[model samples]
Target: MNATAQPLVRFRGVGKSYDGVTPVVEGLDLDIQEGEFLSLLGPSGSGKTTCLMMLAGFESPSKGEIWLGDTLLNTTPPHKRNIGMVFQNYALFPHMSVAENVAYPLTVRRVDRAAKAEAVKRALDMVRMNEFADRLPKSLSGGQQQRIALARALVFNPRLVLMDEPLGALDKRLREHMQIELKDLHRTLGLTFVYVTHDQSEALTMSDRVAVFDNGRIQQIDRVDSLYETPSNGVVANFVGDNNVFVGRLISVQDGRAEVGLPDGERIFGQMVGAARVGDTVRACVRPERMTLCTRSGFDGGTPSLNTMHARTAGTLYFGDHVRVRFAVNQQEGGFVKVPLDDESLTEWSAGDELMLKFDERHLRIFA
Candidate 1:
């Protein structure tokens, strides 16, 4: 994120409110870099869709300015914005053929018949929908219809494309395949994309960066790896992946580590994440995969460090590639350790078995 690099789309203090009192998007300041795929990811009604609508010029901002390059887009109409849009339902014209649907954008702009045909052919080819040119919307499958919708968006050669859960209508397998295809298309065309979705995994798979929205505000914005590995807050940590939270009082803070006193007179050390002081209540969060589990006999009972925990196995869950072993520590539901499927210990574990869970201090994040 170079300070001087110009953004393709800029939202400056943007806010959107439908009822004039309750805002859907509040004070959103974001930058979509040139040729970057940025996803607005959140649960339903989290303002991600509203942000996309605002950027697409379908909905005007209640406050702040939106800029596409140097032009102010707050006053621009949707048709004049030179932006492509794809919706969850495909939004194809039922009466039109696939080719005709792809050419609809060009037709709206009064493109000549010859040039519109050429653009339609090229767009259809790009989406691998060329052979379906003669097919009507009703005759095509959901995936094929989505391809036609994408072709229509790209036919007009727009610099930016906004997609609102475009893959929502497809089955899981098709949606995954289309995610790769969409990423490839974005790379080939070098077009900026603003995608909206409630699916966290989809956002992580397709976007160069993700902005996570919650309660009409952005919770965090970062690359997928950063968001998963080092979430800025507990909300992000819990939302992005499986996190084990231990709420305790801070006993000490020194260097880059803090000590948290658990309920059962146990103090654990973890990497200091946010501002906290002695006597402050805090949460030490760790991901399931970071924890290593072993039988109690394998580990000597020594002075507790940030990395060690004693627990009893509650149960185990098989996820094909991995095993999640649930544990009960200090009377809390505590957390689970993720063991790889290849590990033979996964099958040996039983409920009520005492175990020691170990993790590196660096993997634990402390937040107030």
Candidate 2:
């Protein structure tokens, strides 16, 4: 996102508490750019849903302010906020036909018959559900019901939408299909979306930027690529993707890199993440896919900046696209390397075989 982009929604020093004792959302300061799909992702009870509720005016902030453009939303009611909302349960009125359900928002605002009919048709057409307009919510499949719910949310042509795990009720395949559909719909509508979900893959698949929450606060907020490639903290790193971490003591820091001394008396260089001084404890983190296996002789004259460690293969697990090779390094277990299925190394190694595991210095992230 551009630095000067105007925010469609802003949470400035916002905090929410149930009993005025513990904050469920604490001091949140975030900006959602207009027309961007931003996801609030984390595990259950992480306060992502609370943030969405606050933005939609269903819940008020305990302290500070929530703003939509230049309007203060603290005193506004949900119906007067002009924000569309989709919930996990598909929240459609079972007694109403699909068309009527989609038109309910327009009906509440007293739109004329002709205008409401036209708007309903257009919204249903956008979700490709025009053919099922007469079907009741109970008569449709789970995926179809979700489509109607989405159509209803879009029928009023609101500038912003808040979705709280809208696809959580579908099966795996249908959920995946709806993810693509939602992305396309967001693109075609060009409306700002604030989505909340616990699924990491769903967040990565559909978000322009993801804010990871834990303990009622955002751990990191960045583009999907940046969150996965360079997490700001150990919590964000472990929550976003698979990682292998090794605890060590900081030995030295120079330039943009630092040397960490492992328990086995070996030192390795990596990019520093946070404030660290000599003699401080730190963790060296690397992704399994970033490490490669090679014979000792093959690594003798390899890249000068690469780090190498001696390891013996313990076992291997086959995933369709890749193979996970577990190994023991420096008498410690839990170290593994991932090899692509097409790589010859998958068939060339056996249990108890010794090899060198090599990773580039730049790929190693040091967290203090």
Candidate 3:
């Protein structure tokens, strides 16, 4: 968001191609700031990994150029880049203990014994692994091993750190715990982090900004809250979170709003931008949590409401902290409403009941 300062890493029209047939990444332009945590999120074959590999010097750009601070990095080798990397498998040396593993990078650069030991100890303590410094990786838990790997990556105090699905191997609970720990570490170290992952929740939980990639291109990049609430297109809407999609056609445009007719016998109005006209096909995306369930007592026929949909409850799922109500929206089309368990009215609602779904106009996103 700071436009005046130069970025720590900049990619200007960067691209990659394997056989010179299809570019793995086409025309990528990004600026990653210092001391920020960013995530590249997408499904498999989306080119997120390809971009990370290019940045790490494992691969070269077929076209365009990459900049790290003041130096252009397209021709730089991996050893000269001074960037640390962490892989999904932890990548620890089996024969080495924790301290030794953390010391490998410093030893490779020919640092003296005293400096290497001090750096290793500081890195291990940063990740809370200094107590287990002498233990082999095989003797530690998955989370502990990951900590050792992180210490190894940070022991050299590199300016940038690239992580490829680094938390994928751990269990869910440990993964969540590490997410907080990693964010705190990044703050304390004040280093730039480029993380790659397919998990939307993980990205939303940890990233300062996220780049959503699809089909070998960057679809959208923004703060996590903006990306979830106002997705630029349908692909980003469905991929970033659980959305109830309503396919519609633009019927009219007035006062910066477009009227859309949904297939579920609902006519709605939503905000739109860029090259949309009457009779053009479009889509409306609404998040489940943004919907309000209206019972018969509170139901009103006429109001300033823009959209309404009818549904019959098919089932209810209790998630301990929240409740998920599944219903048939229109014929074969389905919908779900997620509500917190603290809502008192939901206690009276049961399966097979009729309900009206209402949503705020500000939360409705239209894509054409």
Q: Whose lDDT is greatest here?
A: 2
What is the C-alpha lDDT profile of model 3 across 253-334, one tens digit per residue?
8776778886655788777745678888887778999887877567786456546777777787898889988777763367
* Model 1 spans with C-alpha error above 4 angstroms: 1-4, 300-306
In terms of lDDT, the poorest run of 10 residues in model 2 is 295-304
Q: Model 2, residue 303: what's the lDDT?
A: 75
| Candidate 3 local lDDT, residue 302 | 47
Taking all chains together, the TM-score of candidate 3 against the true structure is: 0.96
List per-candidate RMSD values in Å.
Answer: 1.8, 1.6, 1.7
Candidate 1, 55-174: lDDT as tens digits = 898899999999998989999999889999999899899999999889888888999999999999999999998999998999999989998899999899998999999999899999
How badly does each model clash, as a count of residue pairs? Answer: 1, 0, 0
TM-score of each: 0.96, 0.95, 0.96
lDDT comparing candidate 3 with the true structure: 0.88
Clashes in model 2: which pairs?
none
Candidate 2 residue lDDT tens string, 1-368: 45487788889999999999989999899999999999999999999999999988888999989889899999999988889999999899999999999999999999999999999999999999999999889999999998898889988989799999999989999999999999999988889888999999999999999999998999999999999999998888888977878888999999969998888887788999979889999988899999888876666656768887777888899988889998877734467898888898678788888888888989899998
Candidate 3: residue pairs that collide: none
Of 2 and 3, the candidate ahead on lDDT is 2
Worst 10 residues of 1 by lDDT: 300-309
